[model samples]
Target: MPVDHYTYRVTWSPEDNEHVGLCAEFPSLSWLARSPDAALKGIRSLVAQTVADLRENNEPVPEPLAEKRYSGEFRVRIPPEQHRALAMQAAEQGVSLNRLVSMKLAA
Candidate 1:
């Protein structure tokens, strides 16, 4: 079987300590690395894992030949106190607020 591939333009933005952050058009998928090339390589790894997961779970894989891009937006609301707590916890854990939220939601 041939594995279909989708191309994504990943941007590397500098973070603290000379590390760079990888950002894709898809918000759920990003990574941080010590170098720009490493960040882009990390993006490929992440995308590959996502594809594998979709296949393993028998989820419908979007036909990249047709749907070259996918985008969506939604709003999430939380109590102000709870939001502040999460932010503090994320900072303590040395991760982004978005990452902390993602892990919590995934669980």
Candidate 2:
């Protein structure tokens, strides 16, 4: 039940006028503070509390994104015109469409 590996991020929140911390595993939970460090700590503390509560209640806990396995393959749909454009670009670059898309995405 370790939560340290859970994906965490801190960013400025325009609406709240403060830094906000977010956890990927628990999207519904967040912490707002005046500083990024405080925001991060607050979210981590909140997550620990939430995890303890969940375990106490016998509720299922979410798997951390870092602990999940990915196959490196997923399908994405785009407009036919965009598809054709990418295909043409891939051909011109002497690469497969998948490779072209992967390079673009990586960039």
Candidate 3:
């Protein structure tokens, strides 16, 4: 598959004074160019070469984040005090802590 099929982002970097392109599946890699289009092209080429190198070495290539499946659940860590406050709020609203958090996140 073409590297462009993967998740890509191009953003301006004031420090570098250039556009930076990054691929979500290859977080360690980046390409900088004068223009957004050039940056994207450069990053895509880099990703393609990286994929080829991995394959040549018989190493596993990471699946694109866009192609991965999510179970609609993830864990988050909160401070004990915040956790207690949220639990009390959930109780006041007659809902489970999970439901209360879900509602807040959706909002």
Candidate 4:
């Protein structure tokens, strides 16, 4: 099931002063606990219950981020001047503009 592969994370929340568990697939839902382990468990259980409820209601569940395939292609718009500069840099580096941008984004 996609729910089993859903992206999960636990991080500290200074505002709440407790650990927070999060699911990328369901951004609106979260679990809080004193410890990271408990937080993670809580979130996982919450996700399971939520998934069950969604299924019971015949609602479409979100696709798991880990289970989704990415084409590694996307479009972005930048200022003309910045675009020209990147082109010049690409020329100087002897690489395609796409390669130059990809390298910069990776860094």
lDDT of 1 by residue, 1-107 (tens): 22324544545454554444333433577667777677677776776777778899998755544445445334699999999999999999999998898899889
Q: Judged by TM-score relative to the true structure, which candidate is superior, 2 or 3?
A: 3
How many clashes does each candidate structure show, in the order listed?
0, 0, 0, 0
Candidate 4 lDDT over 19-61, as tens digits, reads: 9999999999999999999999999999999999999999988
TM-score of each model, in listed order: 0.44, 0.87, 0.88, 0.94
lDDT of 2 at 23: 100
- Give all candidate RMSDs, comma-separated: 13.1, 1.6, 1.6, 1.1
Candidate 3 residue 38 C-alpha distance from true site, Å: 0.6
Report clash pairs, candidate 3. none
Per-residue lDDT tens digits of candidate 3, residues 1-107?
A: 55667999999999999999999999999999999999999999999999999999999988877778999999999999999999999999999999999999999
Estimate, for each residue in 36-89, the C-alpha lDDT of model 2 and write its tens digit.
Answer: 999999999999999999999999989999999999999998999999999999
Clashes of 2: 0
Q: Relative to the unseen true structure, what is the C-alpha lDDT of residue 46 in candidate 3, on a scale of 0 to 100?
A: 97
Ranking by TM-score: 4, 3, 2, 1
The numbered model that scores best in lDDT is 2
| lDDT score of residue 84 within candidate 2 | 99
